[model samples]
Target chain A: MSRTRVLVVGAVLVIFFVAGGILIYVNGHQGGQNLTFNVTVTGATTMKPDTLPAHQNDTVTVNITSDTDGEVHLHEYDIAFDTRAGQMVSHTFKADKTCSCDIEWESTGHPLGTLVVSP
Target chain B: MTLAAQILLHGFGPRYDLPIATALYLYAAGGVVFISFVLVVLFAGDRVGPNATEYPRRAVSWLVPIARSPWPRIVGGTVGLIGFLTVVVAGFFGSTNAFYNPAEYVVWIYFWALMVILSGLLGNLWYLFSPWTAIYDALARVVRIEPVWKLPDVGVWPATAAYFSFACLELTTGMANRPAIVAIAAIVYTVITLAGMFLFGREEWLEHCEAFTILFGIVARFGPLETDRDEGGKISAVYVRPWGVGLLKPAPSGWDRVLFVILMLSTLAFDGISATPAWQDFTVALKGYWLPLGAFGLFAVRTFGLILLTVAFLLIFITFMEAVIYLGQRKVDLKATVSSFALTLVPIALVYNAAHNFSYVVVSSQYLIPLLNDPLQKGWHLWPAVASFTPNFALAQASTVWYADIVLIVLGHVIAVFLSHLRAGERFRTAQRALLSQYPMLLLMVLYTMTSLWILAQPITRES
Candidate 1:
């Protein structure tokens, strides 16, 4: 090939690769499902209970149900397990003495919420 | 990407918490030390005399003797090659392992030993011996096969641009991204090299910046410019010389110096403001909009500073060279000039040492560990080594901020010493001596080292 032709071909190939990477990233994110949860704390404590808490070595079953029409993953207390639409998933977390056992929910294109734990 | 975009994106990363008071103190100290050291060197005169010219003459003289005894070369080269390979492997592939491994003493010792051997015996000999520089130079030569494009005759600005751009990358990016940046930098360098070759041919690129040029010049001041001596049994002072000697002289006016100082101050100001909590919050608040503007402002200031510094250095360098040449031609005593410059390096070394070690002093403190451990989860936040040292007092917990403040306090002394040493000369040597006598900071260093060791020995606790 002529030098000009070779240069042109090389430029095109570079652009193609970069464009393809971007496309893949965008599509993957778009295709991922969104999940939402109405997190309410119910425990016997003399405090305004909007957040859940557990003592050291205490196991608490976190009941999660998704209202949205997509799969959502509950990344609670360092655990990443999924919950399907209209289905409730109960996750049990053992609270370590050093860390407060708080639940967090993560999904595509949505804000993340934290379930605060206090001893 | 746009420069603004790049800066804004980079600002999202962690920053070191250095306070205004601490910075001012350190800056003042550094200034004093640097000026004092320069003055001292200036007054000391050339104690070594012409016979003490050790670079090129000794370099050549010792070579034959060393050639006769090859064991030193073999052993040195072997150790160097091994260490280089190990560092490359560890830095690239085994960084996590190296980071986690508590036995960092081995690496430290290896590096210190290598640096000492190279600097002491070779004297900036790493220019020739460094495997990385060697590889870069070789690749640069290889890329000359296709020399189609040419850079404009901007002079020094291109190199200055490259330096500051690399500095930005160093400050912002993780080590992993540096290789890519280096590759891009290498390409730019190769282009410049080739352009120089095309424009000035071989002499411009090789003779001017050649490793042996300064060495030869230093040797020539003592006796000979080259091995070839004259009919009168005297070594010739002039052999080969660089072109355009007139363009590379002292500035015509004092305004140049004033401009340079202003530029430097502005750059430092930008650096200072960027490190402030207000700057961080402004960036975060502006997020998508004002952040880019801030970044652009920083880049502009940084570039301007670098350019001004380069200009100042060039002016000073040219004047010094002219003085040397004039003295050499007249056969006047030139020993004092060389000695003064050599001694000036001491304060510079101290300042650099203190600046580089500041991060270690800050990070290894007793305060940072607890705050880093307090965050739950093994996610992005759990990365203590990454998140812990951030200077954002608002974003970071109180404990981290408190620890950072303490570090700043210690760093202030280092800066003060640096600045004070700058003015140290015969007139002020007594004052400098008095200052030094008052505080034997070496004892503090020893205590700090012991404390660090104790801290490292303690098992990491998850809970504060």
Candidate 2:
């Protein structure tokens, strides 16, 4: 085989490996069932409980209704569900086993809550 | 604005143990030193010569023959390929989740390890094994394409620009998390690769980004690179004859040595700051002041201090290491030194691992409730509350205890650079020149660090 052919083959192989690995990682860590919940944001600009209860494989639906305009994000968690003034932002997350949910509202700087999952 | 503020301060700051922020700052400082070093080397190129001696002479004997063999090269390429595949697949199919999974820690460490190892052991080994590079090389051969229709006669700037662009991506954006971003990046890279192949041909692309090469040369300065020189019959009797090999020789000194010291020190300072707990409380205190001024003040003091300390410590350590290598009549192997230095990163990684897994271990397991309830905080809150206990020892040694690996990585480069630049005349080599050009970028990094610290200072309201 020509040197060029060898190089191309190597490149293709690398691309394939990288793509395959990413697929497996995402699939392996897929959270359990999809969930929908009604979330209401109340009290001093925070996310209230600071935590919630969900099963290891359960899906959560968070319906957030806030009186104020707050930006909600699960920083470092790759989860950011933003809400507007008096508007609601709903998000669904696959709950891992024994995980605590850190729901943060950036606008109010007060709404930091956690969701405790019961195994 | 408030949300942004909060996110910057309490959210990212206290979380991730503030190491990421510190790393970004260090990266910025390295940029500055790099630019300055390059300019200095260019102007003073005449003065620099290969006057330095290499260390661990026997190791070079072993490495040279092995380097000629294709096995180590192939193995290195395979490792890189695996890592690339994992990142691509995960980005595509991973379900959206709230927290960084503890399990994924293994993969993160793997990526970090592989990148460091390749860069440290073989200079620019990634280019040889890089899927991107391979693709570019292959395409060039088939199509006879070249990216640069007109090769600029001027030296280095074009490549430097390309590299800086990529570094910006690595610094500001989280490309790994966003599939769209990653895809776009991949596409852009492909275009650049093909363009380069079409214009400058495959060899140019291979030589373009040299981040790994520069990193290796810097880290293993005292090792094999020093030894693998064509001494050209100057001082051949003292250094070359002693090694019983043609490759081993002493380095000549000039501006390159000065610039090398500067770059090593800058990186070390950044690493030291990351390891230091002193900045944490200081960051908190600075935030109590007015936003803009507080931010600027914080940046000035913290970054300046970090740069100064890193440079001073690196200088001291490098001088000492060189003395030892010289006295022992040892020739340094870049690969071995880097591998040894890489050991330090393990500790830093472990610390981050613990910090990330803390919630899972403490809250979910119900093991640390008693410790959390200690009288230190004056009452028993919850495990999360108790975890905030900042003992002096923990803070003092946080980098060593939690992120020893990062410290080690930084120190490894310091020693490598010091040993490499110890020669009398050959200090202003190409690698040293390249690093000198990056000082401006480092200053920019310092500014960014200060901004981040300022963001951390914003007051958190009890409620929205």
Candidate 3:
């Protein structure tokens, strides 16, 4: 192929990739199912999966049940609420943006898991 | 963190990591860059393109006023000095809260990310506005500080050391997040920089020991603007040119320079890796045992890991260079190959920096105004009323970051391939031999592209 044709082909490929990325993002956000993660902490030991993935605008429900009362803070989402012992704290929110933030216990600096929300 | 790593970990955009998007982007970007490179080698590999480094200058005389006058530097330097002082004061006396402190944003986002970005885009604005340089310039005018002592013969090695050392501190200690530490570090750095200035002439110290100068100087080659000094010691015309043309010039021909470029990529690579779930798990598991060495032990382990990674990268790069030598059947030493190909890697580092931090800077920059209004948290609201104002994170969506990253990374690799192709063609005197040499480099570029995409695809601070 000529250099000019080759260059033109390269440009088209770029546009294709860009459009593909946008399409995935849009599809991820358009009315996805409500995703829930069941997290249980027993005396500082994690007995649950560490990462839960959700789409942007999808309802992300983290049901935290602990033997000891502690607070969980989502770093990127910048939201935190208290949890009580023997009581399940279901913190449900809209998954916004692509973020993989470390969820931490405010009292002990123990990282619980990750909230992976993507657009 | 060294500013780079922190921005990567705290990357703004999307709520979750998009593994699918990451995979698609990587496959597409890598495929396009690789195919384009092979085609270019086949069709146009024999000769230099129109934008070759030796091309004639097209004069735009209107830039004469700005280029001739030193006012831009003087004004910029003055503003930089004042701003530096504010950050220092804010770090020392401002609120302990990092979010409320202007110094945090100033140090990490503005000076760290923006400076590196601007250098790649606008040709080393640091030279015109470095607070350290401005201070030394003022002192030199009165003191007549000559290069009295014999300066170190090391070229860019000192900068590499300084960059890594600073990286260690940033990663281990909460320097970027803590106002007090940032302030103290700034003071210590200023004193040492000034002392180095007095020992060796200001120009010599800046050229040698200063990390930002050496870094910005290299990346400026890939930028659109090319500024040089005339024999009269006056800043020459702001030569406007196409991107990547400056990379063609045969400057920085030394082993130290090659090592410096390697270190730049290595440091950033480790930073990217350290953010991954696997690395985090290993570090966390190691930290328990390492803690016996005292409060500082875990940090030491992490820093050592960074050093080890850098060495690994160096080994891998050298092996590629050797492959190129063998493939082309050229009588060349490893050092010669390194010098010839070091400029090719500049685009990768530049794009990586942009892709890693662009969303974070664009989205998080909104915090600066509110922080600035009540910098010390003195509770005094400035008239700008930017306080209490928060930026909607939706502006820089996760999809946007992915798109920008894929485009830039693919483009950077293509440029790098083209650069190596041109240099190889020029050297071998035949396009066929040049193409033969580039097969090795092309492999390395594709690998590098895939590695970068993989890093971005992973979770930054996952609890593994």
Best by TM-score: 3
Q: Each candidate's chain A: what TM-score?
A: 0.42, 0.55, 0.73
Instruction: Between candidates 2 and 3, name the one with more favorable lDDT.
Output: 3
| Model 2 regions lying over 4 Å from their true place | A1-119, B1-56, B59-66, B71-75, B78-114, B121-124, B137-150, B173-176, B209-464
Arranged by lDDT with the best first, the candidates are 3, 2, 1
Model 1 agreement with the true structure over B347-398: per-residue lDDT tens digits: 2222222232233233322223333432222242454564554322232221
Q: Label model 2 with its docking quality class.
A: incorrect
Predictions in order: lDDT? 0.32, 0.38, 0.70
The clash count of every prediction, one per candidate, is 27, 102, 11
User: For candidate 3, lDDT tens digit of each residue in B1-464?
Assistant: 00111332432112223443655665655565656665564545556433333633466567777877778878888977987897799988997666667777777778777888887887778878889888877776787667768677877788877877776655544345677887887888889888887888777888888887888788777878766678997766667876776887877577788878887787677767876777877777788677787867756777777788878877888899888777777675567667768788788877887887766678666777666566787767764567667676665677767777777777777777767777766555565666787788888877777777777777566322
Per-candidate DockQ values are 0.02, 0.04, 0.37
Supply candidate 1's per-residue lDDT for B229: 48
**Model 1 chain A weakest 10-residue run by lDDT:** A41-50
lDDT of 2 at B118: 36
lDDT value for model 2: 0.38
Each model's TM-score, in the order given?
0.34, 0.41, 0.88
Count of clashes in candidate 2: 102
Instruction: Looking at model 2 chain A, report the run of 10 residues with the lowest lDDT sum.
Output: A21-30
